[model samples]
Target: MQNTRIILIGAGIGGLTAGLALQRRGFKVSVYEQAAQLGEVGAGLTLSPNATHALEAIGLGPDLAKLASRPARQAVLHYRTGDVLVDQERGDLPKKQYGADYYQIHRADLHDMLARAVQANDPTAIHLGHTFLGLTQNSDTVDVVFKNGARVTGDVVIGCDGIKSEVRAQLWGRVPPRFTGNIAWRGLVPMYRLPPGFKIEPASAAAVGHKHSMARYLIRNGTMLNYVAFAEKSGWETESWSVRSEVSELLEEFDDWHPSFKTFLAATPKDLCFKWAIHDRDPLPQWTKGRVSLLGDAAHPMLPFLGMGAATGIEDAVVLARAFQQAKSVAEALLRYENARRERTTFIQMASRAAQERLQGGKADGYTKKEHKNEEFLGLFSYNPATVAV
Candidate 1:
């Protein structure tokens, strides 16, 4: 297994994590990305205990602590009245309960961290500007072709490509991801730009309304506030994160929201506001076929309600590395990874949709802690992918 050459399609979080994990385990890994330059979008992501534990296993605990923020509290608020509907402690609570700390970090920071670590292991591990076209696999090896007229063969091919994965398309025709009728607008506000006496109590908060919701959290060492507003709409189907929108339009959409939310929106930089359509895919019946397999969004694209999309992908990367270490052959390793991950990823996929319904389907005033189904309430944080049965 030490001599096995692993090929990864896409250099997103999952792909980078997988590359780093495999390199740490003494496996030769290569990552191909479609972009000309390597960078993640300007966005914030929550790292639950499961994801933190997995990163810790790969020796990133200290680095993560430096770049991520630990929110002391979280809350659900009524959109109109700004009343806190439910509040929960998050700082030391997650560490005590799950044996790992929960974090909120900028997506680009985490991506850069993983990419740097992977490159440190092998300076030539990642190959950019190589758009994946397709692959042909046999009983012994898998040959991957790129649009740049580059062809590489490896013992295993892992499709970490995103929802519009060309690898997945080659394996099982082009199945379009279903847009969940939800459009989201995201923006970041510098902490200094807010009005005087503005409080960001309960460091992370979500304001729920009728058919609309907004979540805000501190990131980048509490110097920037990241917020995403969701609304069920139709006729707009673009899913690109770089699509910019007017701050005026954003304020118009939530004019009736609580004063605090409106204040945050007003302070957002015009260029920082981006709008995108949220899309998800049905769980695949299987993830592995012979020596090629799928990982992260390629296998199971998730809704953002539960904030587990990145976490699950990170978990997949860790378990995949573990599977390779325990299996005697490439085929067995792929099969083991598929079997160990299917159940958990599938559940999160379905549960995230359910969470969306709960957050947007009803009145915000009706929300209760007893009926809430978030990552914490669903026992997702308890999963220790580093030590789970892989």
Candidate 2:
């Protein structure tokens, strides 16, 4: 493994996390991100216990607590009329029962934390403005082709790239991510603008309701709440992140909803909210092909339901790092990493899809929050990466 190098494509939460994890494992890692800067768009991200375990392994757990919240109570579900469905206490339950605290933070905050960690830990390891185009692998080495027509050789390549990964296309052929028939509109609102009573309810700054199976949460230390608006159709003319998200479009969706919900939407700048097409890919037969493999959204893209996307990717970084820490050879480590993750990540992907359906209400399963006893939720959050992975 002399001069072993890990070329990670896509410097997202996964890619940069991989860089940090791999570096700690004694590998020279370089992360290539297409964006000119290392960052994420507006939105909220929930870090379940399991994911926090992974972050903790990378020394980010306590630091994250500063910019995020561990809700003293669990999620409370309500009907559109504000009738309480379930008021389950989540504080002692998830932490004591599951092992890790359920955390919610702004996507940008978490991104910034990880980005800074990568730079501090391994300076110049994450290079922005470089896009992955394809990859070529031999038995001993892999060469990553970038959009800029540059080729970097490494011991192996990991497609921590996102849903639209070029290396994934070259390895498994072009399998376009399928639209989940749902579009999520996300926005951020200042905490002061919210009604005082809008303290702890879904659809309000108080709660990230699951009625539409949409996700919303307060980030930036509760000074603001992130809103995610979702629907079960794709009437949108196009699907691109760069397209301007209109505020009126977001207003129309919650027109008849509660005043608290309305006020948050109104508070948003006309261009603040973003339209994101919920896209996902079928589980691949294998993530490793010779000396290159897939990671995160490139290997498994998912919807926002169950709030595990970022967590899962972070887990991938830890697992990948640990597998290499254990395996005898680099290629064998890739296979081991793929074996450890493919099935678990696949389950998460399908679980996210199912959650989307439950949130949409197009197909009702159980309305009572007590009945929604998330057996998987506890299992999903209770990952202790330090002991578990090693």
TM-scores of the candidates are 0.99, 0.92
Candidate 1's residue-wise lDDT over 162-247, tens digit each? 98888888887799999889999999899999998898878898888878898899999889999999998889999889999999
Clashes of each: 0, 7
Cα-based lDDT at residue 361, candidate 1: 75
Best by lDDT: 1
lDDT of 1: 0.91
lDDT of 2 by residue, 1-390 (tens): 535787888888888888888877787788898989777887787787778777877888778767777666554334254445545565556678766667788888888888888888778888878888777677777877778887889888888888888888988899778877777777888878666766635322222243454445667767877877776665653455555677887777766565656777777766677787777788888888888888888888877766677788888899989988888888778877888888888888888777654555532324665445342443676666555643
**How far in Å is the alpha carbon of 267 misplaced in model 2?**
1.9
Superposed model 1: Cα runs more than 4 Å off = none
TM-score of 1: 0.99
Provide the overall lDDT of each model, using Cα atoms, as 2-decimal numbers: 0.91, 0.73
The residue pairs found clashing in candidate 2 are: 50-381, 74-90, 199-206, 201-206, 201-207, 212-359, 213-359
